[model samples]
Target: MTAVRVLLADDEHLIRGALAALLALEDDLVVVAEAASGAEALAMARAHRPDVAVLDLQMPGGPDGVKVATSLRDELPSCRTMIVTSHGRPGHLKRALSAGVRGFVPKTVSAQRLAEIIRAVHAGNRYVDPELAADAISAGDSPLTAREAEVLEFAADGAPIAEIAERASLSQGTVRNYLSAAAAKLGAENRHTAVRLARERGWV
Candidate 1:
């Protein structure tokens, strides 16, 4: 049987090394390339055209793993993508699914599970970490509008309402409305708490 070609992309050296070692033990898998950053990952993907690409969500580049996955899906449709990261943020999952990644595995998952997920994605199946899948479903219950998300992001950075309004090009009242809407959606009592929660969930 032919071995499955795989590419690995992650920023941390030790984590990448550990993953490489774990994947090497799989009889049907071959690690064809390794990348330390999103840019390097993109270049390596273009060069190697591996059967599967395991990506770290946060990396150095203009766009993160989701964008890389989307690009690969568009330019190299045969190459599958799986996102592996420590962050199991709902927004990350939402964005990754939209980008066409076939699998999502958090760093906390065991190496055995990670390998299984990679192979599953390569074999044309979808995989989502059980913990994250539950969170993602719950996260979908409360939706934040794009405007509200923008205001919250600005507010999280210590921007005042006036500054946020100016930055978002909305009236002060409109900014307050957005913040209020976000607070209500998040079940928070105030804008500060809303911002904190949004930040924690990676909405901003």
Candidate 2:
């Protein structure tokens, strides 16, 4: 049998190393590339063109796993993407599915289970952890608009309105409006509380 080529992307060196080592034991799976950041993950994906990419959900220094999956959906449709996240927030699961990720699972899964998921995804089947799917179903849809969500993400780090405006390329007044709207929708007294609430609900 031809081994399935896999790309492993995670920022944590020890976890990535351990995962790569564990996956190496599988006879029908071979890790072709490894990356420590989302940017490097994209670069490696382009360079190696693996059959499946198992990405960490929150890699730094570039796009997150969902963003990378979306990009791959456009640039390399042949490659299947899956996310393994410790967070496993309902919103994140929903976003991953929307981004064309073939599988979504918690980091608590065994390596053997993860290998099975990879094979399943490679066969054009989708998998989502049952608990996560149920939680997403109950969480309901995010109330924040696309622009509101974007602006709130900018405000996540407590950046001032001017900085957020510059980053989002909107006027400071517009930024304040979005923040106010988002806070109101979330029933938060301020943008800071809104950010916390949205994060807890995985809406931001």
TM-score of each: 0.91, 0.87
Per-residue alpha-carbon lDDT of candidate 1 for residues 53-170, written as tens digits (9 for 90 to 100): 9999998756688888999999899999999888799878888998999999889988888888888998899998888988878766447988888888888877888999998888
RMSD of 1: 1.7
**Worst ten in a row by lDDT for model 2:** 195-204
Candidate 1 Cα errors over 4 Å, as ranges: none
- Write candidate 2's Cα lDDT for 1-204 as tens digits: 799999999999999999999999998999999999888999999999999999999988789999999998998999999999998789999889989999999999999999999999998999999999998998889999999999999999999999999999999999999999999999999999999989978897
Error of 2 at 114 (Å): 0.7
Compared with the true structure, all predictions reach lDDT values of: 0.88, 0.95
What does candidate 1 score on TM? Answer: 0.91
Clashes of each: 0, 0
Off by over 4 Å in 2: 159-178
